[model samples]
Target chain A: MTRALLIGNSHVGPYLNALKHAEGEVALDLDCIAAFGDGLERYTIEDGVFCGNILDPKVTGRKGKGPFPGSEVRAVLKDYDVVLLTGLRFSIFQVIRVFRDLGLVTMDSSRDYATAAENGVTLVSEALLHRLIAERLSGSLMMQIARDIRAATDAPILVLAQPRPTRQVLVEGTRFETFCNAEERGEGDFVSKTYERLAQELCAGIAAHYVPQPPGTIDGGMFTDTSYMMGTLRPPFWKKNGRPVDFRHGNARYGARMLKHVARELETL
Target chain B: MKNPYSDLPPKAFWKTGVVQTDKVHWPELFVPKFTISANSAVATAGSCFAQRIRQALADEEMPILDVEPAPAAVEGDLAREFGYGLHSARYGNIYTPRQLLELLQDMQKDAVHKALIWERDGRYVDMLRPNVEPDGCASVKEVLELRKQHLARLRELFETVDVFVFTLGLTEAWIHAPTGRCLPVAPGVIAGEYDPKLYRFHNFTHSELLKDLKAIRVLLRDIRKGVKIILTTSPVPITATASGDHALNASTYTKSTLRSVAGEMAMKFKDVDYFPGYEIVTTWARENPAYEANQRSIRPEVVAHVMAVFLDAYGLRKTGAADQAEPAKIHDDAEYLEGHDDDLVCEEILIEALQK
Candidate 1:
């Protein structure tokens, strides 16, 4: 069986759960090293070796969950032929910062931007975002991981971009989701192209790959379609007041769908 | 037997003018010919130093006209770094009055016929603004398309804006030899390859500077009949010179030429007003030193002082405006160089970096 270490932040949960229930002739054993918040910042290159006490939930909280990803994640990494890295520290907030600084959106232009985003406008072009991050944001987490992993092992790295926020995100209009929608509208391009360009550059930089979101998952060119997002998360989610948390995360079914795409691409690799 | 000096205000002399007390004396800085109201549509474009006022007015919740505003989702940081909120439109930095005039002309043109996209290391750059994009555009077509949209937005900004603020930054510029068009930066550093046959350095003389300033006035007049012009020279000195003289001498000559032209035009026009931003930073703080140790960058305190006097002199106070000026955000010279030293964006500073 081909062992695939799916290393990431919270996005790894669905993929791991999906592969667990999945039954197929496909020879892939999944392992994960997941953390939330600034967990990734701990895994630094110390004395020219790559390792971290990656299981400490107190330091990098698992959101009040039991049975954390095994402590042998770094050991498992060496045996895996491939590494799936998802959501390494980049946020939609960076997009908001870029958009605001560029004056693409003004104080009075919010409604127009929101409407445009609702209609599938991504304000920052994929090319522009790619170039900005590739050139200016080298200190980004993905960049660091790419460099460190390239140094540590012979196994190839495949970066899965963070999934698009759900349709409810746009419809409900939370501050974060609203910004994401506006970012999409203002950019005005196929949202997946951002992941592709970043992947292309990273691959060129470190001989790895960037796997874009499956084409069908994105609807109206900007957001993740509801079909892909429905009932995906486990333990569901909620606040202390018993209100359901408005997470943009998807379910194991969503991950199962994503896994099919990843398996197809791995055939060529 | 009253002498002419006897009747003059306290601001007339050096000792009684600014140095008599520790308290900030704002009476002498500016006496406006026309007041700026809260809803006044102010359009701003200039050298890097002009960004301070652009940001300050923005802070005061004044209506600074932004014709080509970024999509509303674009918050302050993104808008700031990528040429959005830096000026009235995304034209990057207009370092000189001539460049401003050229832009206004481009806006009026039915078709911007020859779009210049420079190529360096197989990537395309919008020659009009080489520094705006982090890397470069995908193609010449992309560059042309963005420039066309920029001009369209700029045309709108010029039309509706009641007040136009343009800062004069430099006298020296690289221009296309045939068309006399000003290049924001010298060729060969960021995008275009340098060709002596195609390009030449032109240190605009006082007459040339005045003519450009007057041409801008005329263009603004023709575009919007009642548009008022407020001129200021960027107090940030010419950090480096391509003129083959010492940087100190080049800066002195450049500042002198631009200042003289501004003074002459302000005196010559009914609508034009000259704010003492240059004097406030350079001459007024002779003892306290407005400039950093490098003598190139204007200190943050000085920037604060200049803008404070500016708002007090011109800013319209609504019912509950903040009375006291907040502590100014400071960017030292090293800090400015590492990140967005926007004032120097359009200038030919990159060439010096290339040499070393």
Candidate 2:
């Protein structure tokens, strides 16, 4: 029996079913170890151990640091034949900070910038900003994590570059407001370029496969929390009142597409 | 020497309600003396109609220098939405020479000035936008300086170009409120918040268009001396109009003005010619067939035919016809596959053909 470990952020949700479909088509035994949360918390994976809150409707409630410890990552990975590491969405704060540091954004006042920094927005030297952020959570880090898991499990490591979401869905009033704000500040291209560079760098040393999602394919089910309000909103679009939601996460369709590619890659593996 | 028109019937002869055969005397129309095919590097730009010209030449395997960037990804509508690759082939229309010149000048200037301001969230942000400026120009000096640099770049591009094609797209454009500079599209269409005070519409009259065309011709001559120019009018209707005229009438006026200017320029300039792309698509192709159900854009087959006619006019032929040929495999994978067409009544020959 061959097992495949899957590591990714919220975007990996849709691909779960796709991975299953791929396994059947390719006739490979596969196990997905998907971790989800805010910040580095999503990296925790263990059965029954909570790791971060589930923002998705498919899953319920907040999860603690998991049933499995970070040290147990290698042990759990040991049973898999191959490991796949997907990409992560940038934290909202990270997006805001990057733009603010770059001088691409001026605060409403100097006080706002200082306030944002004091509010746990990591302040680093201007020269080290991009490099520091890149070193910490870039796709390369994910690749290294996959490599470590592979070493422990005696499985081949196959890192998958994060598939870009076809659409950029913005939800107002949610914590995701920072991303939309950054996008408005003309940082959309900057963010995209950074992600592209990260993907390229991740694929450099590793035998990884890059799969791009078809452009403009996002529909309503993906960002279920954000609604198009008729009026009263600044942008006239805001998050609906209810459970906190992460509209930035990819829907099942995105996962389905990635799974197809993953399944095809596994056949050769 | 053989009479080039010897095969043609007399003009007095009537057939199909025409005076004589519409057959062209290829040798007379395209004299060998002027049929030099050099390894020229031509740059094509104009309104959207210019795209058709490029595609037509490309379909015939004719070499033309295309400076546009390749797409970043394969799938989806990015290529179309962003006006790159095949999307440009279908919808690139340059409305005026001034706008085209301005774009070239800006590209040239952008090469040196790499910084660009991106507007996000009601703020301006500095971002790195790649610059591929034309040679020998650092920054735009003035409108006249831009014109001079544009001419220089055109000369450089034409030195290696055997034929230069430009399609005039529109006569109406929005001018910058402060600078009085004409923009490619209205400000609000693509970018920038709509400010009525900051923008005003300028509809160029026939005389104004002619003056611009003359200036462009002089610029072309100053550079390449005798670079051949071909002009066409875009047939696509305007998405919206500030003229307060009905959209149909606006389209007619725009197309008519462009076509008339093109015709006049063709008559006046020795190296200038006009291709009837608008008439070909709107009248010839439109009258022939219905468009595909899903897409209202011109049918692929019609585009192909238009391109073929274009190639024939330029005395160019497709190289490696077999290489360009598409797959002809029939779907006869299995007996089960054949059962799907069970309702069809087939003759013995047809059945034999299918079996074969």
Candidate 3:
């Protein structure tokens, strides 16, 4: 069994669930550690050890689950065969910021921003993607996180593109519908593809394996299917945008799908 | 013989005023009609050169009023590329007063127009200031919605800013024929079809420049009680011209007309002040070919001198006597001189891409 430190923000939840339901005896022992928002902003590198956040007894962790690790927990990364450095979902929003800058949308209103991204498309393969993201890799937390772990442990690092946010229709006039209304084939696909492509290139530059999001997870476009996200999430922004879209974390089924992809890729490696 | 020169201050003689040793220092280069104190909120508009003022103000830690600032997480050149923190609002590169005035009108909310959006490759571009968003908006609704907030912010700027540093970059402009809306880049440069019927080119004469400046003055009259104007003509030459004349000859006509108009406006209005930024840069570049080899991009050191002189004359930063000893080079804005992120997006640069 390959001991893997499945470390990231809320995305770790689905991955953990994926482990519990893996086919036959899954050959991966997962240890998850994460904080939400800038929750780990307090963490620091003290001496040779990553230290801090987990030290705080009061941090309501990813989804208010208790006891996510501090910087010191990075020590355990040495024991793992592959360290999965994942997200606080920074890449998606960064892509949103880029589109907003490009003036492709009139409003930074979440609905308009989301609609633009959900509908935008770009035809980029890994080499082209790597070129686009190579310059920006160091600037992202995922790469920084992996680099920091590399400084302490020689474990191979693998990264995943932030799983697509829930695109469910919990409400009749949700913002996703606003995005759907605005969607075209190429332009809408461009936005999500930009993030995935950027993430893949960034991970590769850091010598980390870039595990793409599970196939069929994205429904013939940039969006994750509402089916994968339906039960495993809580919709914080639900009903406000006239849809209960959990634009952040995904459910267990989504995690299992992500893990299956990662395992399949690892087997090939 | 008490001619104007004989009785004038020492600064009147070239040897004393500008040329020789003990030449009048940065502050004496042009006495500011109004002081821009450290905290005074400043707004910059018009031309690519105007962006230098915003950056210098930010470097000085002066309160540059950027209402459409890129979000905090979007830092450095990437933020700049997105067209954030370029001006007081997201009104990107107001290359002429007409464009500036159009933005002011758009801010009125009622004056917002639907016809300004330009399309290329199935994407909608905000023709008014096209470069700010390179990819164009996904939908017309997105464009309008983004513009509504942008206009709201522009309206707020009149109330917020103490100084408006407006640089006149060009006399030649392309506008929508029927609507007369000023397009930032000539259509087909950034993203638009150059339709002869819909788009018409006009090289503004001195009268047109004066009339447009006065129009801006009239609009400013009602907006805020005491907004100071520091008008300057950009020393950066136009990259290409549609005028039948040589681009160099066209550049002379553009700069001269803008200078004359600026001088006229300053003379006509008490609040409007014309700074000799044009003379400073052009003269310095003549003495030392301070432009890049292409003769289009002004060397970063030249930009440094412009900022240093301006800062010494008006704001909190004053050039030291030793510093002014080299009056030809205002070296205070060293980061700009370092030229790290100075590959500014000049619409004129797009002329190379235009099908010649």
Q: Give lDDT per model, in order.
A: 0.67, 0.46, 0.67
Ranking by TM-score: 1, 3, 2
Candidates, ranked, DockQ: 1, 3, 2
- Candidate 2's residue-wise lDDT over A167-254, tens digit each? 2335444445545554554445555555445545544434454443333332321212122111112222334454333344444545
Quote the positional error of residue A160 for candidate 2 in Å: 12
> In CAPRI terms, where does candidate 2 land?
incorrect
lDDT of 3 by residue, A220-245 (tens): 55567876765554535454335454
lDDT of 1: 0.67
Determine which window of 10 residues in candidate 2 chain B has minimal summed lDDT. B127-136
In candidate 1, what are the lDDT values of residues B1-356, reduced to their tens digit?
88989888887876777677333435666786677888889988888877887877887788999876765544456556567677788878778777888888888883453546677776677777776665676655555555666676677888898998888888988887767788778888777778898889888899988998999899988989988888888888785788999988999999988889988988999789888888877775355666654556666666766776677787553322223544444567776555343343443555556666
Reference-based lDDT, residue A144, model 3: 67
Model 2 residue B298 lDDT? Answer: 43
Candidates ranked by lDDT: 3, 1, 2
Query: What's the DockQ for every one of the candidates?
Result: 0.13, 0.02, 0.12
Q: In order, what fnat does every candidate score?
A: 0.09, 0.00, 0.12
**Alpha-carbon runs more than 4 Å astray in model 2:** A1-269, B1-40, B68-93, B101-159, B284-287, B290-296, B319-356
Pick by DockQ: 1 or 2, better one = 1
Q: Which DockQ-derived CAPRI band holds candidate 3? A: incorrect
